[model samples]
Target: MAVGSASYLELLLASDTDVADFDEPLTQARAKGAPADQLAELERERALALRVREILIGHRRHQAELQLLNDTAHDLAALHDLDAVLQAISDRARRLLDCDLAYISLSDRDRGDSYIKAASGNISGLLRALRLPSGAGVGGMVARTGAPYSVLSYHEDKSIIHTAEIDRTVRAEKMVSLLGVPVVLGRHVIGVLLAAHREQRTFSGRDVNALSMLAAHAAVAIDNSRLLGEARAAADELRVANATTRSHAEDLERSAAVHERLTRLVLDGKGVEDVVQAAANSVAAGAWCW
Candidate 1:
């Protein structure tokens, strides 16, 4: 029993072993004419080992999620371009979930639609710049609602309002399963991050939660990029305004000096030709008086 228990522990610790693999030692003991009660004891031990494996796997998954969040925060701090940020996000989501592809779609308020901005695992590139109306499909609906949603069949799912372009693109790519989470800011949904599969598959709750967390990070990046652009634009406008103000001030000073010089000539008993010549010179030199 001691040796068998140790072997069970070893099997549980093996990274590649599964629940079916845990039966090796018990099978061997049974072949050696082990008593019924002893076999039952081994069965109980196997059940315990499987439970331990579940807990261990779950803990590791949780740790990975925390690490991914930290990495995304680092990306936001280190990268400036929106395309770079979004590509990193989509790549990470695709790799983490083991999905066939992952992509990002941002809402365009002027056009009242969402368009794919970045993608990973997209071999054909047909969907890279595809446009979807605000309520046209899964990604668009998520953008409108600011919620996470998943579907097993993108083509057959009646819940999604399929548009001609979106449906055609998806069908051409043979995409089946999809999950989308909104990139939200305060009360508005600004975009969506999505994962897809080429075949029908259900998204687990954990998958939904994981994508939601990633979408939250994406939202932060989008908001930061927009704010930075707005700040730069405002700074540029302020610079132009300041330059124009300085130019007008210099013009006013020149006009005042020309007026004072002409007035002094009149008070000093100078001829009108001298004042007129001075006025002409000032006018020629771009002086203005009102």
Candidate 2:
């Protein structure tokens, strides 16, 4: 046997003592010249151990990769600010998937449309300037479907139309593969997460799954940001309204005071001299005469 294979077999044998223990009595009998059957059993046990070791090693590597992905997702969830969250997600997706372009498109719910909120790499500037109506293209279709979609050849895909802005700027129809996943919160689709490769390539199922998970994180972050902004705006309006109400109340109180003084002067039936003196004092104090 080769050195590497021999070492792997040895390690496996050491780790699984039950196999060795079963072989121990057989080995002792063989030492006393018992039979060839006993020696064959020892070789069979060693083979089984090698197989188990290979399976165990494969499982361990898979588990380690899963743990790393989980850690990255937790980090994404920790971000609160909407812009930062989108940017981080886009960056991570681009790096993890080895895509040429990645972007997050947030829906403008009030306008019934969607716009790219953040992007990474050369397409970032182009995405920032683009907006798509609901159900317009791949991103919109993903939003409407609320599911993941992928195209291995975008140029050949008749459904995709290059935005006028993108055509004017990039001038390269180099993008060939595209994938989009909806960002959904509750029953509503909030946005779309997009990834694309420059050359025609089929996206793996794993890539789609990872992008979907990232989209979920983005949806929650966007919803929180919208709520926070609305709350601040409402607080400002309430403050302004309160100030207006107070000003109106103060004006009413001043008018009532003026009316009371006028009524007292009339009710007293003061002589001409007293009335004239009161009028002179009121005029001197800048009171308007009707």
Candidate 3:
């Protein structure tokens, strides 16, 4: 059990690549017949060093997760195209959760189901065209519950109401594990953000929280896009109304000018030919006068 205490101290101050430097020295010391007391103390130091390494790695991982979420928020804020925003969220989820594929499924209250809206890293059309009825699959459960759901092995899981179509599609995509979080807008669950793997993988609480944060971002993006579309439609209507009003105003002004010209000709005792000529000058050739 002999281990290098010096290497243990170095481990605490070392970079990730440098942490592996302890094992070789530790093996050499064990073979050299080091005294039992010294070996025990070195073992204690080695355990402490390992614990420190674990904490350091965990902290770095958490930091990276926060950065990913912050980057997602910035991206959503800058992006106006709904499809691009959705794809960005899905792609970021795959990278953040270290999963093989990620997708966003939107709830259709009208249809009483949730349908795939966007996906990343998916090769099969099955996943792209997937539509899960409410309470049928992991996504559907999340849609109904408005809570996050994680599965270590989806097909084998009996906790959810798995439908044949969803099961068949999941099998075709070769998805083993899954995680879904509700994309909530106000009091309603508008959609679900998901991450999946082809191989069995555990979803940690941290992973769930990260995906949930991104789901919140997705909700805001959807709401903002909806508002923007509405504003554009209203503006278009306003422009059309303004154009119509301008056309009517121009017609009224021309009619008033024609009337004034005819009155002046009558006061000057102009002939019927002069009056007809003045009317023709003010109106288009095909326009009739009574």
Q: Largest TM-score belongs to which candidate?
A: 1
Among all windows of ten consecutive residues in candidate 2, which has the lowest summed lDDT?
A: 1-10
Decoy 1 TM-score against native: 0.92
Tens digits of lDDT, candidate 3, 1-290? 33366667666776754556656555666788777776777767777778888898899999999888888888788889999999999999999999999999998879888789999999789987888887888988888888999899998899999888998888888899999999999999999998999999999999999998889889989999989999999999999999999977777776776788799999999999999887887666423333
lDDT values for all models: 0.87, 0.72, 0.85
lDDT of candidate 1 over 1-290, digit per residue (tens) = 78689998898778898778888989999999999989999989988888999999988988887787788778767988988988999988997777999999988889988789989888665798598887888997687677888888988889889988898888867789999998888888888999999998888888888888888888888888989999999999999999999998998899989989999999999999999999999988788655
Judged by whole-model lDDT over C-alpha atoms, candidate 3 comes out at 0.85
By TM-score, the candidates rank as 1, 3, 2
Q: What are the clash counts of all predictions, listed in order? A: 0, 0, 0
Clash pairs, candidate 1, are: none
Q: How do all models score by TM-score? A: 0.92, 0.62, 0.88
Q: List the residue pairs that clash in candidate 3.
A: none
Q: Write the per-residue lDDT of candidate 2 for residues 203-285, one digit (tens) a residue.
A: 87877877887787787787888898999999999999999999777767755666567678778886767766766676676
Task: Order the numbered candidates by lDDT, best leading.
Answer: 1, 3, 2
Which candidate wins on lDDT?
Answer: 1
Error of 3 at 158 (Å): 1.2
Q: Output the better candidate (1/3) by TM-score.
A: 1
Q: Against the true structure, candidate 1 has what lDDT? A: 0.87
Off by over 4 Å in 1: 288-290
